[model samples]
Target chain A: MRGFGVFTTIALLIAGCGGGGGHGDPNPVQPTSTPAPAVTATPIPTVNLVLQLSSSVGVAAASFSVGYEAGRGSFSGSGAQAQCQLGSSDTLAVNDDDAGTLKVAILPADPTRAQNLALPTTLTCSFDETGGTVTTAGLRIGDKKIGVIDGNGVVVAGDSSRLDVR
Target chain B: MLLVVAAVGHCARGAYAAGAPSCADPNGDGVDVIDAANVLRAAVGLPSTCASAPAACDLDGAGGIDREDALDVLRRAVGLAPTRDCLPHLQLTEVVHDLDLPLFVGAAPGDDTRLYVVEQTGHIRLVKDGTLAPTPFLDLSRTISSGGERGLLGLAFHPQYVATGRFFVNYTDTAGNTVIAEYRRAADPDVAEPTAARVFFTVTQPFANHNGGMLAFGPDGLLYIGLGDGGSGGDPMNNGQRLDTKLGKILRIDVDAYPTPPSGNVGGGDPDVWDFGLRNPFRFSFDRGTGDLYIADVGQDRFEEIDFEPRATGKRNYGWRITEGTHCFDPPSGCNLTGITLPVAEYGHDAGCAVIGGYVYRGARIPGFVGRYLYADFCSNRIWSFVRDGARLTSQVELTDDLDPTHALGGITSFGEDAAGELYVVDGPTGLVFRIDPE
Candidate 1:
């Protein structure tokens, strides 16, 4: 009876420490009658990105990643909101609807700048959804955190804080 | 950043916070929250400020502050933008006066070194050897009306001006009609025989306004004359569409041969008609390198248009009395869907009222915009450029404020080129001449 009492106290202490109800014991003694059917779920793909400055004037480089859901499908190209001078160049990329990636480089006119610095501190990559508008994710300069930007490349609310690179 | 936020927040609180479904600030004093927010964002270096709130910083009251506003402040602060685009840069250097009263401006073939200007009262002036000859080269003001759209409207030296020393002028007669006349340098080489006036072609003007009054020699050596639509508003006469009328059309003539010479006229020829359907073609020029022709036509009410005629095409009809500038007139008659030429560049009356044609910069000084065509406005005082790639024309920039705005060239009567291919502007109202140079 002494031994049984000691065993009972030990069991109680273990259960309490584990914080698990009787159904979820770390070392369950239950042996399933039949193996649970193989659980199969679609895995979300991860995006990789990098920012490179062609003309160096100490401008910060920014990067970002986007996530796709089951119904969201895939993304196409990406864009950056930049203060570019006349004849400054910027590069962008994104995942396409078919899971492929699209990339583009844009050089806009900026005749006013003496140094011709093109600072695209924020970037947004988006993908088209099946029934809804395009889903977008953004990245501030030198950070991997994704946010939201409008169609015109403006940072929306809740995403404004993430765009501060300076 | 704090200022921007405060301003935006204050605006949002004053306007949108009121909770009016359709808010109306009667005095238009309510600040736009979105705009304020954008200003803050831009000032803070957070993404783009203008991309979202374009109207918040509309400092010029033009409804939105896009690149123009940004550029405006930057230009005012920094003097001028770079002259890489079509807009002229601020004159960091000195503003020199090569010649005043540079009436008519013309350049010699293949050379920009020599500049020729016509004195409005008659007589051609030359800027050669870095000095303006004190005497008149040719005197025809006595024969010219010297009135509206009259006097010496155009001057064109033959491509072989070095050999022939021959040139032509487009002026209005005492009858206020369009005349293409020819003249030659006198034996003294410095003076012109006033009696040496030779009538090339005379087209009677129906009214005072749309005489078209620009004469240019194409690379093909065909003399092209621009005649305006018989004047009066809305093209009441519809002379532009009529093939029989020389008014409102470009007349291409072969002036090398004489059909029936005027009794005292030294040079006479049947001036064959070129492309038609022009309304007050104030100025026109041939691209020195490609021979492409550019014509600037003044609009009646709504728009000012620039027409491009490639050297290869003949008898092109620019839409006049029909579609003014990519838009149909109020009544919309005679603006046919077929067989009408369109302008390469156009602007609204609000931006500029009249079009002043200028030369394509073939000069070496402006390397970035060498192939681009430069033109100006009479009222808005704006100078603009159009870059042609093959047949496509892209607008480059507006350069009004970049120029000396203190001297608002009320009427941009003509553009002149020096012996070195540099260009000059003649303001009719001020009788002042400005030369375009590199900073």
Candidate 2:
């Protein structure tokens, strides 16, 4: 019954997550576009948000997306390189439109987690912290609302994680 | 103009006009913006412009039509049932090598060339392009218990593994406890990311033996697991008839973490369990064709039995200490079979000491085994089968006569299938993965 789909997820960010003052923003990872060769943008001030899970209750699949206003920013692939144990059979998708948005998705190779989970998991993302009035649109765990953590380590319900992406 | 892929096979049911399949196109065709509009009317009980068929409309099976049925129809169109009605033979052909105490075998969805074999020593080996890969797909021996009915016990691939590359396993961890974990194939698609292991669930075992560990994705898409009564002899903990513990029961959970019941047929709504009252249901299988389940529970001192149930007979209690198979076990005189669901067929120690549950042959190669439930014994090392009509056992025969003894099957631990629905057999001692071939 829980559908953490693209549109539903987008709607969560747009409708549920509210914004705040402070030019701080969580830098999200931006994926590549068409045949345009690789080019790093001008250095932009960014804040990395690390969401820590209270329990590694087996995350089979997950995704996060947010929209903001700033000079385009992206993730540094900076935190916990192996934050999650993804299988060669798993799928990790990232989408960051140069405009002002970013999305991250990970699907595990097994759903039952018969091997137990990599407990106390953490998600580290990056984006322009100065993106004027930055806020989270949505965060999902296993396509369901299990809470998410802000860079401040403050836990927020997945469906209503309106904390400043900063 | 929107050309929808999910829109084609996935449609809204019940809301269709008379005699149609689903809501989107009614005729079970592609979807359009107005598809929801056309179906919405019928769902709300207002007449619909789309055609509706019995398969889509009469979903509740209550001999009536309503909005709930309409909503259910829509859910059904999203996921279709697997193919059934396959008749296989009751024979065997040796394949694969000393799988190292191979406990279970499974093929990834949509992948026909590859098969995964799980060994009791905590290693999962891959059989690709007709041979065992040099490297292990997974190695959990460092964390799993390796001796005496322990180690890796069960394996099941995600129904959508072709697109998900996911699979589940049941094993006894180093702590001497039962554990169910999930692992994904690494970037190589062949090897698993050992570090990516995540524990889905775990249970502390009371004893070493009877650590019932068998997992399978049900026809409903919910992950179904079979756990024994915490592994002691004669139900010492009385876990078998006790609903309080997960031991001696079959549990079901939506791995996607999505709401369950996929399409109803789930008779009980306990949310976490499907049935209970089993004694080391070491192996069980759902007939690929009918979605019916056949469970072979190991006995205590005298009997070995097989219990059969349809897709919706949820919350079943297969009389354990109270009754073994269909007869009285604990009670010497007056025992009741009243509320208890007895095994459809049972055998004595004279026939086979331990019942190794097999599958209902639904393969193309074995024309003879098409509708029969094939099973074997560990002590006698003999094979047997029976036919199931609805919930009853109609015929019983010893299949050991059909097989060639020269090619010892070792000790049958589990049976598995490939993407094409072919049959296979595995032995925990010799590690041989056998297939049912031409008689």
Candidate 3:
């Protein structure tokens, strides 16, 4: 049990390290403590968001929706999908409603590969902030909709880090 | 290891001593889902409490403790009797072969020597005494549409077939509409009169796929038919939840009275609709022993489900567009589950794509096999069975490895039960009819 706690702490630390540049509010608090570092400087052209998925007994499939500030930012680039660091054969689909919700679903093609995945996998995506100077943008994961299935076809409890866009 | 051998013998008995702390329930806390999980953990070499006594974990007596052992314990955990001894040493014997795309198999009442196989191209072939009949019993290829989830899909003989010489068929017409028709046997017992095809009402299909064409006579003597949710994908028509349409429902009617629906059907729907909210109930069956109904609804993307309805219950709303296999589907999250009947058992696409519902084994030939409901998949060709203990589904064991060791049974499309309650599987691609037999 203690070893599992250490593994969880390490995963959280890795997620915390990614917050160095974008500096998202890890907690669900108001964006008051830290002012936008890039608001005064040259307006940040693009902001990268990192999503971390943590499961104890590996992951076979993960599906969740991300709701972001639509007025301040819009998903950019050719493929507008989160480039997930999953198995090469995994099926990944990302759909943007253009409003605020972005539905992301990942299903491993080879189930055994998912069973052998290392814990705490990461996915990264970028969006272009156009309107006014963008500060720490509002990001929320849909509740009661997220599902992370494990190797045994059982839906296991999983955790994902909060997203903050600069 | 005399003690180990004795333990193996004790565990392989195939009967669960009620409330006795056996290998499955090592700590005697009354086996539940946790014990089932622990056995699975041990099978994968993970840290598990059952790992301490691995000998006892060998539930099937297959020389070593593996996933099958864990599955057996899971059966016990879910209030089902042990089927450890019946798991292995089963084989599929090819009874008939070399035919066009066969979709279903059946036998008339009191007719044990002959089997009737339905081909998708609108012909009912006869196999008698292990010999294929040169002439089809009934042929309607010129009149019906065939191919890709259409055609003559279902056949069911009346409960009093011997006395009435009557049988019904479900097929898609040339205009792509579902047609339920009744036919009678000719002077010869083996041949059916093609001119006797009496057409019932026609159901206009919206799309090509998801044509749920399965016909069966319930124990109550009512003819039941399965229809898909108007084809396409994800039930876009929302026909599953709609009462105005009979697209995603199990329709019941009395053939003797033409279109008169029997009493005790769910109120306030299409008079023919007995139950609704099914995506594509490709296949369903009634247990000869318990008279319960089992419907295997193929899932849209992720899950395939097995729905159960008791003999006495009617008017069940199996959640379809609202949910798929016990999870929110339409709204995608937090959908209302009120007044909905969920599946008794479900598996994801990792196991199979489409579920082919099979019958409850009540045949006398296979010992310790009765009361278990068997099912298969079209894409995976994997055969699995589970015992339903009251409302819970227990003892889900995959019989693919033992039943089809050489993979001779290819792409199972449907299962057939003879008059004597013996089961046969229909291989659509290979046109092989395999009878499940004990080795």
Candidate 4:
């Protein structure tokens, strides 16, 4: 029992480590202020995908998928869109971790007017084992390529850069 | 090593179990948009405490939680079961925008770098390398009357544009005549010399509005033209059924094959007319896969129709003044429906005002959506598609529902497709271009 408790404590500490040394806000509305876990002199196995879109038309929903080469570890995280999906802003729901598919939508959003830039969302997938190649595909902007952002602050439309898993 | 695998197995199992659908009750408010919004917030790195039932947010019950789960939950909350095959969840991504009244958009035969857009004010704008080129391909504003339903209306590139560099445009000239003219690309390959235009044919218009101005190169490499029944309501000139007028006709000419000046082609499409008796065929398209032709003919008072014909369907008379949408028009009762080609599908004003013809979903991206004919209504802003089950093209389904509740596809003027067979749509009111992408 003591050993189990110690391991649980270690796991919580890792979860509390918000990429950087700081803590995550957990406010549910404000943008999460941390980048994905950064690799130090000793590389850590984790990657984050920050997808941002600005459309002349409003964004009601969006979905995407990510894949990694073998040994890249499994990924999992849905930050805000899940809250938007379930009609609550205060709830934390990590969703869309199956087969790498993620989905989100703003219900009752504008049906006529052109929307300005929408706040970006992130898919933080944690890979336990790392070292190889990481690619992102299946961004669901109605099957069209829209703008996207990487954790390093690079934003592009349709085209994306692959991450080295080392 | 066994312990390590066992520990990872326990973690994966716990993650999946924790993400079960019942965990979505963060605030105990039941699964709702607030919860869905909370999921979105979480996915985008926002802080949310689905502390109550976090797994509820994991609608898919996958080991991890993300927006796809949120989407499934949102859909269930909204009572929508997505039928992936029946509907084309097409999303339009804007390709280009901001120009004067873009009437139609056409892509050249072989060039994938540029999209040729015809503006109603007599200019052909080029969208090259993802941005609008500063120079106009050809500006006939000085020669065209830029008013209601006139100006440079339609554009069609030569089948071998790489070799010929020649293309045809249909427009109403300053003298109020429908002009079929050909222009060649300049030596620069990016810009075309407007002065090098050769007039192919011209028909004087008695009235304006019904001037059907759409040009396309048939699969057989011949140029096809769409014309309206000579304007003033009810086919006033009785031109639709009259075998002598170019008005109310879908003309076909061997302009590229002839490679010469006009011989004043007229009646019975002698030198160039392929078919006649149409009322304002606002738009038309040829199936890139089957070479079948479709014409969206604007109705007189009641219905908007889509007429279809096989590639070799020569000498067709789509009864316009005589019949509208398979119904009697001129005589109203005794009008003969025989011999004249009929519309494959049609809708009344209760549905929309004008029809914008569209392309077949032959693009390689969406396999399930293949073979479906996509089209739209200008007034309703609704998009629809259907596949032919047999000889009859049934199974009509609405594809633009999601768009309707979130955006206005303002006045769909025309549809275009790229060299890759990807589809595009144009709305006159927004003066924008959108590509149809599968969901």
Candidate 5:
């Protein structure tokens, strides 16, 4: 009986193992028909811009120009920049080269007092493409920058720059 | 003194002798008896330089002691305008009193009247005859919070305080709520104790900053309380324009009668909301003589405004969210300038930072400034005065240099007055008080 039982158990175990292998063995390995493509990074574009001021008072006229790619693209434009003369008539202009060079000039209507006026020494510019909101800070004419202003022509900020005179 | 007078009289009558310098001609111009008597009085006090016979009697400096000197003496005696040299030099007296926890002050109707000062942490002090009473007139500091800008921001004695002995106080509680409590002094006019305390109205403040704690009874006898627009910057919640919320507005309520019975029942549902659209009306006062109301509304930035409300008008809107001092401040619709009541006077941040409302000087002492309304700034220590004629408000003038410039105490938080119509200013930072008088 023992010999018959051992032979039957070994046969059942072999059948179970064969059934498990049969259920798990299908589609063990597969190959891809096509390969994925690699991605390439893009570079950002840069531009050199210049801003110029005309008359120093009463909605003073101003002009701006952009030079990009070593003079490959040169654009000259005119628009109003809310720049006013500090206590008198002063004007300012800027020239920028796509080669990373910026040149700024302050013209004083009253040249005799130009030395006394401190022209702004720094300028910060920022813009938003979606909102079209461009803001500039630290803009100086001679050694001074316009401090405060209202919707009216009244300048609440201090004006020590001789370049503010239009 | 009597013997000298008698000798002078004898000389004037020529009784002593004929050559007695003709008795110095008491009436040098030879006027009548009354004129001669006046001239004699004037010449009697002449010094030795002027006492050279007839020239001595020329007290008028008009060449003689004649009718002119007599008239001059008479004018001087009757309190009429005297000549420049004869005018008496005026002197001023300063009286400083030490007060314990002087919280708020109010004045009633008469001369030689008393001033009521409220001490934070509770207790009402009475300054009568320029002396503070030893005991407190009333005490309620036990229930007061005494926190930021809280604790007895305002006190108003009913116009008929003499008869009614009733007064009101606006204070903040432990929970940071503004309460306008009414109390009646005991039968004894001097003591504030033995009084009945009653809570007339209570307002729950969302935040502490803009509580608008000033309470004043307007000319109409209605209590007007100034509440700040719930205190965060920029009016983030839009509390000023919304009428349903009482947060940024000056509220008027009739405290004479309870809307409901003595029980906890409420009736008529707040018929007291008088005017709205205010940021934080720090201090507001009505002209004691005229009923016009002047409000000092503290602004957010760039501007401090003084709003004027004529007594005749009732419902006037002072634009808050939509406008600040006649200018568009917020975005979208900056300011609706059409129907809003504009401020009579406004100063930029350069001149003054915050506006402190003051009383209109109706006192008799300064007759020239009788109808003018006086106000000051907390930051710049500038004193300003405005005159309103009919519906027009004149430009304000700086009344600086009249009071002690050092008395501003960093910032002026409140202005008070005594019974005689004298004005006082309270400095918030230094906790000092100054009385404004004629220079």
Candidate 6:
């Protein structure tokens, strides 16, 4: 039953994926927070790492959480938005304070809007280098892994080539 | 929460691009958290962002997207039973017209294409493949008394109808007595062998008005019969409380053994009396999905009711003259309500007069209606539905507006469920039969 449901949902997603080619949003939406106390401090270097889903199959929905060493730096931006143009879709990014991770959920409001992302849909995460270096090994998707629903409602099992952070 | 609400409101006001699909997903992506959130907002009476794709949100087809729709979407997101199909809107599609005061509609077991309609003039007509057969399936007009609730009223095909070719009927004989008779199907599948009707049970009716002519086969394979309290106003004969008489009671008899009472019936009464104390149980049915019983008992003066009993519950005394729909009737002010089972749902005469019982929807065509009980009023051209959750009645929805928008199908005589469990409506006054279809 679970397999069938997954298949059905994926198949519906495929219907949403219309035209290919992703649309990039250079400007990222920022999260709001209280102003920190002003003081003379060393400039912290910011690193923008792009988490890309590079599979051939178009995705209508995707869910994954980004985890990193909190002591290294905080996620400078609010959340991730789709670079792929799926019309009338919503992406929800929530920061889990206890787990020290940012959970992102991308779904199309209308199924027909599901489309293939740019060759690599990039989710740029800005990291403030506090103590350790933010390397590809240090950055990882959460233990739940990345769940990408393709046009056929099948969960695209993420391999190194399909899902990557750089 | 505030941010989400604000985003949804903004989306609701956003104009749909030309040629865009009708759904809330602005990006035209598949259903995800955003759509579910929008549906949840609409369910709570807030504006739904699904203005663009409204059909995508109204999953169960009860008209207007609500909480259930939202829940269905959420369930789909998580891979649940209902996918993205919107609940089909209830529309009365005329299937057959020009019958002679049809009172009930049914279908033979294993027969999916034909509908058997019982005419009050004592002929069971067949509507096969959407066409009414010119010849009546069984004609008893000459054998039974016609007019005013007399004549042939109910029919039930045996579960093994294809094999045994046996069926049953409940009607008032020429002498005005309630008769449970068995008949066989002729060589032609659409015809009943009229000469072979073996009358197995007959109870004399004191008055013509409340004969309570409804017959059904229970899940236990026993023939259950409905009879009104000996007739007249207020059940003057007081037959409802008496078990010795089958009047005003639902009797369960083993037709296979010819009039023998099924074991575990009401103790010490007329051995076949399963339940007593009903004024006129005009219509009742056993849920095909759960085997539970639902009876639409016609009231005396004030209230009409829908009574329910879980499967296997025995000897329940539904208050009739003692109480008309949870209110004291016989003693007028304060009669003993103890030990008497009240109706699960009731409405006053202000709403409608005579409750016409219906079946619990177990049909595959309407996913939203599954498990919900649908019934109607004989006087008021209205149909209502509710889902019984344990002992509580919830999700009560009046479907008159959605189904009979013009009220042209006057006087809903009964609600019929075919072999597949899809329901139909019988209009006695208009001599019409309508299948409930998704609009």
Pick by TM-score: which candidate is best? 6
> Cα lDDT for residue B238, model 3?
97
- Ranking, TM-score, top scorer first: 6, 3, 4, 1, 2, 5
Residue-wise lDDT of candidate 3 within B47-156, one digit each (tens)? Answer: 44453334345554344566666666655543345657534346788889987999899998788888999999999999998899999999978868999999999999
| lDDT tens per residue, model 3, A97-148 | 5566665555443333344224355555666677633333366665312223
lDDT (tens digit, per residue) of candidate 2 on B323-344: 9877798784478777788877
Cα-based lDDT at residue A95, candidate 1:
24
In the order shown, the candidates' Cα RMSDs to the true structure are 19.7, 28.4, 27.7, 22.5, 35.3, 20.4
Candidate 5 chain B weakest ten by summed lDDT: B1-10
lDDT of 3 at B177: 91
Look at candidate 6 and tell me the lDDT of residue B119.
97
TM-score of each: 0.59, 0.56, 0.62, 0.59, 0.54, 0.63
Q: Per-model C-alpha lDDT, please?
A: 0.54, 0.62, 0.72, 0.63, 0.54, 0.72
- For residues B110-178, what per-residue lDDT tens digits would candidate 6 score against the true structure? 889999999999999999999999999999898888788788888988888889989999888899988
State the lDDT of candidate 1 residue by residue for B233-315, as single tens digits: 77788777667767777777666774422122112222243666577887888887898888888888888888887875756
The global Cα lDDT (0 to 1) of model 1 is 0.54
- The parts of candidate 5 lying over 4 Å away from their true place are A1-166, B1-103, B194-196, B260-270, B405-408
Interface RMSD of 2: 17.0
**Residue A47 deviation, candidate 3, in Å?**
86
Kindly report which residue stretches of model 1 are placed more than 4 angstroms away from their true locations once superposed: A1-166, B1-103, B110-113, B260-271, B405-407
Measured against the true chain A, the candidates' chain A TM-scores are 0.26, 0.35, 0.50, 0.31, 0.22, 0.49
What alpha-carbon RMSD in Å does predicted model 6 have with respect to the real structure?
A: 20.4
Question: How does model 3 score by TM-score?
Answer: 0.62
